[model samples]
Target: MPSYFSLLFKQDFSDLKAAGNSWEKLSRKMHDAFDTHRTKVTGPLHANWEGDDAKNALRFLEDIETRVQIVQTEAMAITKVIDTTRHRMEQAQKDLRAVVNDAEAQHFRIDDDGNVRLPKQWEEPQPDESDETRHERQTKEALLQDYQVAINRAVDEALRASGEGQKALAELDGEILDHKNKQMAAESARDADKVMDQLGLKGPKVPDDPKAAAEWWKGLDADQQREYATLYPGRIGAADGLPSDVRDDANRLSMEQELNALQRGDAYAVPGNDDRLHNLQTLKAELDKRDGAPESKQLYLLNHDAGGDGKAVIAMGNPDTADNVAVQVPGTSTTMDSTGGQLTRIGKLQDAAENADSSASTSTVYWLGYDAPEAPLMEAANTDVAGPGRAEDGAQPLRDFTHGLRASHEGERANLTVMGHSYGSTTVGAAASGGEGLDADNIAVVGSPGMTVDRAGQLNTDNVYFGQAPDDGIGWAQGLSLGRGPTHPDWGGTRFETDTSGHSGYWDDGSQSLANQGRIIAGQQPEEYVPPGQHNG
Candidate 1:
């Protein structure tokens, strides 16, 4: 996974610069503190402590030292660079920012292509001259002396009419803007996060009934997860609830975070910023705030993944292109934040497909807008997810994802390909057989436990593809099984039998699996499949 985050900001770079400076300062302070702490430890005070208390303090101090060392080790870890060569590069960037700021001040845009365009709002409009006006213009032309006559002759009525037409077209361009705005609004939630909160479709659950909290925790909803998190710090933390509430410290630091994120128009973590620490604070804040309030109006958070950062992160891809599109649904231990920002995994897969098919114009999207439940039987017995147990959890989410794709993009897509990894294969199988609004041309599975269908024809999809690595421990352990138990047999599609990449990260590198997937998208039936990440290519 790539570590650097490309935070989009306005032309000024105000937020970027602020975030950079704050990180640099904080890192320096921590470094200084570490040096001082080490010095103190070197003195007699370091060995003064005894028993369990001393051991705990020593462990804490050791962890802090490791962190400081790790930050110093990575090139981009610290916000500031201390190397000799990079200082000049940093200064150059600051200079470039200054120039870009000046360019923005003018009514012009230096686009990604380096071309300049007139600001949309400031462009001149077309004139509308009626017949009477034209006749009055002709009369004025007749009254023209030598100089006026020369001018009128030089600019003919045809030219005048053409100029007016262009001006009118320019004004009509506003209509194009209006139409596009409506279309975007239709696809995207206008104030999505607020809607999600209103629905109580956020975070872990916080049970309404404190008395039935334990049972409610069993079938915990995202809302009740939050309530439990509020009550968590005192309780050793509930299994199906948000973690402890660090309100006293987190609340105080949250103001700084908001100031940097909202005002600066970027997500910024405070002094003690780490993904987990920041997310803990965010969960508390989300739980504390009232649902449906205007404050939680981040559209992306609502429609996409809103569970800040949790233990697991899952990535599902819906591929749609000219030839054949494929959708990949994943199971448990998958959500946006749980994956340590790795949940943005869909983007790389999209890039891979597009890169492979320059002629086909393939596209990929991640649909994460519904709740899928596990089977009652599966839920009763404890089973490790990512195994046969995963098949059970992935059942409903895959179906929901497929339905979301069909409903959201009807005419915009074509030639579907559905592939489910782990439990997602079952979800795909279920969706293809019958669902609210899901359609697929082909289906495939990789690193899967079992898909519930007998054959591709039975599921009503055009084709079905299946893949399992020769060395995949899970595949070898539970091959071709679809029974009620975790090691159930013969549930996957028969068509595809590939292991282009062993188990994970097929698209990341030049692997056989990714290559074959790309070929499927290109609508070709030629050579063997080549996974992008598997090979050095």
Candidate 2:
């Protein structure tokens, strides 16, 4: 425990902060050095050199790289612990000074050791003393107790902060540098979380309103932002209003942690854990393939869940900076395992949109954030797809996500579009009709069963559009008491032509359906569909 006297007068946090900065600089330098080594030494050796000697040399270089990375990670952990302690101690010092100043202002004397003393008073009441004088003395004594309590509380807070800081510093053992690559990263994150818990700096309770959530994130200092993102990646990653890059970083860390845990066989108790593991691996592979790709092609992972049927939200480009943004919600049977294919589809959509208008940038997202109904072909009749319950439950989340996009976007507002396929159309419809709606400029549904609404006007958006292949069987679900699906002419929305066949072929490259979707996403009107009998030469 720290002494009250030291906390009140002698403690200085500048040196600690400086040390933290030094560690941070060292970590950055180490990272740069490692990158240089890989590019200049190992990369050439692996590409040009051969034989056992070359392999041995490469192995040695790889070990060196691993060791350097571990050192860098450990350095970051040290910086976090030091910076957190400095912040906490500085706050405690500020509190102590505040209470002491208030005590002095009120004519109460505070000693060097934090003891409060009343201003000079008569040792005893004299026989000639007036009643008012005695009462005044009594009042001063009572006030002295209050000042004392305040001083004691401030000192206790300082002591607690100091003790926790000490514990956190003690846990950053140098031996952590001896661990393997993945182990080092996971352990470092785990240790940071412990420090955060000890210092009472757990991740914030994010607000439901996307605007409020964005403001809340902006209010945190840089150190606190980094701590929260590193120590509680899962929570920060999933928070809607955070910046896309920040969310991407946090989610990547979370995915790495999940993969490490699953590899260690720690998730065996979870049902379908193997499937979860496979899905995560597939996602990682897909992301890795995009490394060093163009900025427009880079994938930003907004969120993910490996449990149950699994879920994920991925963006093909940075939505915050794009001129146009579209969120495409998948229908039934969508899960983490299907995320790779979904990413491919969104990429194609992005390309199509960009091709429509070369002057403006576009970002397309695969929003599998909701738990859509999943069932085998044999059990399709018993799935949640037959009911409006899942769509109703998912509507609020979908709305929140879109609002978050609105809150976090930079510069001019984006031309936002929300699209859904199959049952996902039901979710989009439900979201667009309820609450404040999906905050979208256009709502499009392909092969939609129903939108959980009777008309496009009910969706609160005038730019509603629908596309359904003639042979698609999913249209039968509209008769199952969902809503008046957009396929009907009386639905009061534009119907786009679909040149492809089957329920899933709408996204085939260069098809009329895909082209029309691209046009809608680019904020342009698609060519309206005319019934075969209605069209005349």
Candidate 3:
């Protein structure tokens, strides 16, 4: 039998942790010194010095600054790795000891040598030993087995991480040496703005197809990717085929730049800037509100813009790192001004999904990236805003967004659920019915107007889900001008029950609809979710 955490409570973890802390402290000191030199020494030289001598001195100073900053960055990264390894090791040791102690309390013997032995008394029970005693022993044994499995996995992970961290630390000196000696000259001469283009990394071929897009994205190295995103954020931010996290970062930087330009240009005061300024202010307010909210600390701004009525996609958690991701597509009349309410709706779904599976994490994104119809109360509402015009325009973008999520995802594959509500459902359906499909695992619609497809199977997804409030008047428009409602008996999709809160009430707090949505997103068994009409009984 292998030893259980034989290295537990060892001095190596502490030694590594101390070394990491010292390195980080030293790195910080070096960085601070470089900053002082740049401001005090280099600043005066650049202003007062003359000709070639001054130019050479300034270049040397810049090189030293870059080198110091690189070292600081690497040191911080190494420190993080060491800290992670130490934490894992500490937790593993604790878990192993707890398992052994618990087993000992249950009348089992676990020696200091890391041997878990069955009690001698239980090896051959007396004839008088009660059936209850046997049952208790059996339960205890099963519990011990579970604990053993957990600790083994934990120990393995900790050891692997420690080894990798040590290797990385060992290689850092060589890496720094190469950067200074071999790459310094080229890096110094390289134009920051034209680096991507010079390296043949500029103007990436963004394919319309999602799979092709993923391939294009995967081909770029870290440096190339960073440069492309930084230099041409506007194009990359709106590009459909890029990864979600990458797009998110680029979009955020772009948004800030756009806001600054708008402020500088006095956009609100300009003749034709009313729409753009209004959109920008609304988006800014929504972002501020979300940022200020305590519950939204983990939220990430995936995308945002001030173009045309404005577009935004905000995730309550990192979609790239989550085990499950739900994209909520809002319907007609949804704009940048309405984003907060949409965010709230999707944020509730985020919590619900995480709460349903306490062991896992979920991401919910409020997708206002499309130009939704501007439905008004006038008689032309049905033919204008409620028509298929906007939905058709948005179908391709919606498909690309889902595909981008899949391309950028890390770790295990996540369950991707695309949900459409009202006219938004029509948009989802249009995309799903297209030849390329929406690239989602599950397709769900709530209070759908129509999906444009005749049947659920046309969605090209593994599972199709539908929910509708009994009194939802939106369902009445099914088959008239929109697509067929998924809940229709002929639609052949699974129906989930929702409350009587009418249209847009499916996501209401404490509602059955919300619970079922959570269950579906978590990849739980269908039988676990309560279907429609089950709440009354």
Candidate 4:
């Protein structure tokens, strides 16, 4: 345990931080070495060699690769433990200094021995002290005692941080590397979690507001931020108001962990585990395809879940730096399994926006952050399809997500457009009409049943637009369940033209419907719809 005097005056974490940095660098080098060994050595050897000796040698090389990976993983775990320890100790020091400074500010003195002493004037009593003077002295004495207690508590925290760090470091078995342990990754993750618990590094309580969440994120130091992102990825990844890249890293880690656990049968007892595993695997494969893609084409996993009706939110480009951003909400039957199709639609949307205006950058997002209604059949009799309950339930999450995008964006604010398809339009409508609304510049809905509002004006946005295919039956659902459909003339929103004829065909390649949405997303006015025989062009 660290003593109060040593913690206050003699403790330094610079060496610990330097060691962590070194380990991080070494971990990277080890990973690179493994990659090189596989590519340059084993890859060619397997292609050319054919003897039994070659087979044996290849097996040994594979073992070498596994061992190297284990070492790299262990190194990373060590770095995390060191960084977490440094952060905890530094925080403890900060608390100690604050209380000491506060005590001294009030004319009290703290000695090198960690004792708080009152001012000399308070030490001696006045010969003819009045009742008021005596009472003042007693209050001062109590305050001094409180300061001492605070100082002691801060010291105790430092001692615990040091002890826990020591234990966490000890638990990371170096023998795992020598043995080529296949389970080293899981062990390392468990060790990191233990450190988080022991050091109280679970991070601060985050508020639901995106702006406030961003503020809280910005308040943490680099090390603290790393610990929170690595150790508590589920929370950090789902938190709104964090940078897109930060969320991307955290979510990718969390998804990988969940996938690994499920594959290992560690979570076999979880309900819907098989479906959840399939969804995550499909999502991971899609993201893996864009591993080395361009920034504009890169996929950022903003959020994901393996729970009931698993959720996923992904961006086609870096939302934080894009000039134009569009958030597309999906309707019925969307889940983690729909990742590929939904991502393709957003990619096409991004491409359309860029084609409409090549000079400006655009990022299109597929927001399945809400639990859209799902049922066994697409019949109108299904309550999930005809009812507005799910849409209403998703309102606040959608609002928070859009607000988070706005809060985390850099430079000038992006021209944000929120578009919903099918039942998703109802969710968008519900979100925009309730609370502070989505704060979006434009709201567009395609094949919308209703926006949960009688009029577009109730959505709190002036640039509302609606598109409905000629043969889409979803329009008939308007006013039957949710509010009046946005396509209704009395709804008071712009009616955009759509060349496609079905509810799901609005995004068909080269169609006017897709072009019109691209125009709206690019901050331009879409062409107005006209009756079949009314056009003079």
Candidate 5:
């Protein structure tokens, strides 16, 4: 009898044992591996065949193909890393959600030594409840009266920031508006001056203080005396015999001339010319304003780090609500921009998350800054993704992220949630595996190639959420092909890869996959609709 396990690599030993064991025993092992992330078999061998037998050639070729798949995924991961930044600037309802978002998520644990453990339980998010329901639960757990005191402090800061920003903008607006109005007045003054000069009444036209100026201008210096005398000769010449009509005309013209002169600013030029120039300036200013230069919109930026590869942004339009948050981490080819890119993707991802749930909060954040490599990520599905990024370069980055989550204050997660897409999810898993250091409640993983660890429980956070949008191509990239070599062996991610939408579908245009994302961004939990499609057709 041919033994089914007789012809494979040592790593395949568990598979052989399973083949020989009863279905129930094998199922138990599988369950343990699924929930606990502990497994006997990691994968088939990638080493060079020792034997010259031609039969080995078939398997060797298969392994090469697998490696190629891993490499091909590099392009997708690379794009994700570079564009996650430059997201919108909003204020997080930090105070409200802090109590729970940090600690309740269970991204951390307390070891006997009293140190925070990074990962003790994975974020096993159940897709059954809507974001609103999850938010209610999170809020109930986080927002106690005592926690409100602490939250008040954070809220004060946000309010202060918002207030100051508003004040600055208001002042600036006033200044700009005042300038514009002043320019308009100047232009009108110039026009009045022109009319006065045309009438040959170059004296004060419209005095700022009409009554006083009328009394004062009644008298004049040599030039004014001569000019006014000419304009109203009979009235002034015969001091006692002043004509009422001429006096009235002179008074009106004098006031108009005064106004025109003031508008011109320079008395040297005829009042008309000054008015024309002022008007031109006003016109030019209005035109400029009508174009793109109307007003410059300012941006707000925030980042927090826990010494290691943990990098993230704390921003929200409304975190107190059931908002959505996306924490993206890169595998290889990452840099500061990688952090930014993850955020930018979150912004683009808005459409996807919104599609998941129209009524959920849509606020989101991009969390980057892991110890992942700067470049040279895997290129194909068959390649070893864990070796370069997770096992080697990205280890610390992953640690810091999870640790930060654990450090999140517990019992005040009024509205704190997270979505880890692709390599970013792997990063989340790594943080959870640390045994202590994250405090997030709900976590979502989409298009993840691999998270390396054996179990989601090790990833820490309370609710472990996963999204694979059938269209996400990461399945082939993350999973292995049996004929190609081995099966796609994630610690517990096979369940997410239920469709063929490919790597990008997790956030495709208006895809319901991320509808709950908006909810999470608003500090709300994602809706639990496993087999997650409300409209996936």
Candidate 6:
């Protein structure tokens, strides 16, 4: 019998296949039962019940249904993991067998017992060696070289497969353990601990004030931090006072949970089915694109939601450790479906920021953590999304997000800048005008509909920056419903030259606007904005 490592190229995963198939079937059954319980049992009980006893009975049934759903979801996640492992095992075996088959086809004998012997003709030449005989001899030598190359490649792949096979098994073991733990948890008594103080929960207290929030986060020990991150990932991840690195980790887990639920066709993804699918595909494509970029960049998925009015915040590079961090808030018509394009734009800013100052590391964030107004070009003529309604609703989240960044940041406080484009400027301005103060070193707005305010002084930041293109139609919205565009002199900010690429072209590559924005984020002087002759104006 071969050892497990030696059999890595030949091992079968029939057991995993059977397990996965069983789980897949179980998931389907559970889903059907859950639906039936809702329609046939829960609905009727709720409609007919009036007394306390009936209400208590309904609650018990509902709790059991929730537990069943959790099991079904985990079963599906585990099934995917098992299927991946099975495929990897099959491919590894095929690769090894291909090398053996090729060698045998070339007349190099490979016995079942693993012995390789050259043809006897090489040991004893023909009695009278003719030209044809010599040619045959050379051909045999060439085949031998081919055999050696094939075997070498096969061995390299086999080694890799051996290591990866073990790794996959280890991961599967962890998943299995987690599944069991979840089951046990469902059966056990529920803990009454609230996960975060902000939500009025009992676990850990986080203050509303930015500075106090930082101190509250510092008070938690490693065990307590882990507990909160595990129990209430959504709250801990989105909480303003948590550490960025911790928030990133917690948020990633939360994002994965929500994504898995969505992929299973959960109810939350029902309202905007087409939009939800588009958003998921776009999010995956963007993550894949970033993974392919040169050099390793860490991605922090700070927030994600697939329900009505989607929100997402993706950050490239570790914001907690970086010397400079820039957060970009997109404007009108920016939905989760367009996240890939938004991430690319942020990537450009990240690259530009690095080029601006090689000595400092920069983290660029694409913030879509609020419901942006829908202003599709076809509906632009009559859309209310272009107004300040969405901005007013989004302002508080932006303020909290910014304050959280400040609270959780490490080392010497980083130089933070919040950049808003188009209607996003309105949202940022609203947040700034609320008087809580955004705890940022600078605030920049470009091609703005308005900031919901007239003066830069109201923004609570000394280094307020503004940019605009003369031809951009957003200039017309100034002093109207959207307030005043930041570029307006009365806004009382440093106005800089931008590209002629219309309202949305400010962050395009090789453009003066991007270079200027990069300089400001990199903590460079205002005089350093755009190199000589880079701008049209």
What's the CA RMSD for each of the models? 23.5, 5.2, 21.8, 7.5, 41.9, 22.0
In order, what lDDT does every prediction score?
A: 0.39, 0.79, 0.68, 0.82, 0.38, 0.67
Which of the numbered candidates is closest to the native, going by highest TM-score?
2
CA shift of 523, model 2, Å: 1.3
Cα-lDDT of candidate 4? 0.82
User: For candidate 5, which ten residues in a row score worst on lDDT?
Assistant: 292-301
Candidate 5 regions with alpha-carbon error over 4 angstroms: 1-300, 304-325, 336-341, 348-363, 374-385, 388-411, 469-473, 476-500, 519-537
Residue 136, candidate 1: how far off, in angstroms? 69
State every prediction's TM-score relative to the real structure. Answer: 0.37, 0.81, 0.60, 0.77, 0.34, 0.59
Per-residue CA lDDT of model 2 for 363-422, tens digit only, reads 999998788888621245855877788889989989989999999999999999999998
Total clashing pairs for each candidate:
47, 0, 4, 0, 117, 2
lDDT of 6: 0.67
**Candidate 2 versus the native: TM-score?**
0.81
lDDT-wise, the better of 3 and 5 is 3
TM-score of 1: 0.37
Model 1 stretches astray by more than 4 angstroms: 1-302, 305-325, 337-345, 367-381, 384-397, 410-413, 434-437, 476-501, 526-537
lDDT of 3 by residue, 197-225 (tens): 32233455577766676687788875446
| Alpha-carbon lDDT of model 2 | 0.79
Given candidate 3, what's the lDDT at residue 33? Answer: 66
Per-residue alpha-carbon lDDT of candidate 6 for residues 241-263, written as tens digits (9 for 90 to 100)? 57766776566445544554455
- Sorted by lDDT (best first), the order is 4, 2, 3, 6, 1, 5
Decide which is better by TM-score, 2 or 6: 2
Candidate 3: segments with Cα more than 4 A from true spot? 1-205, 266-271, 292-297, 376-380, 525-537
Model 4, 181-285: lDDT tens per residue?
443444555655665566565655777889999999999987567656665677899999999988987787667656656666663226677887888888876
Q: Looking at candidate 1, what is the lDDT of residue 174? A: 13
- Is candidate 5 or 6 superior in lDDT? 6
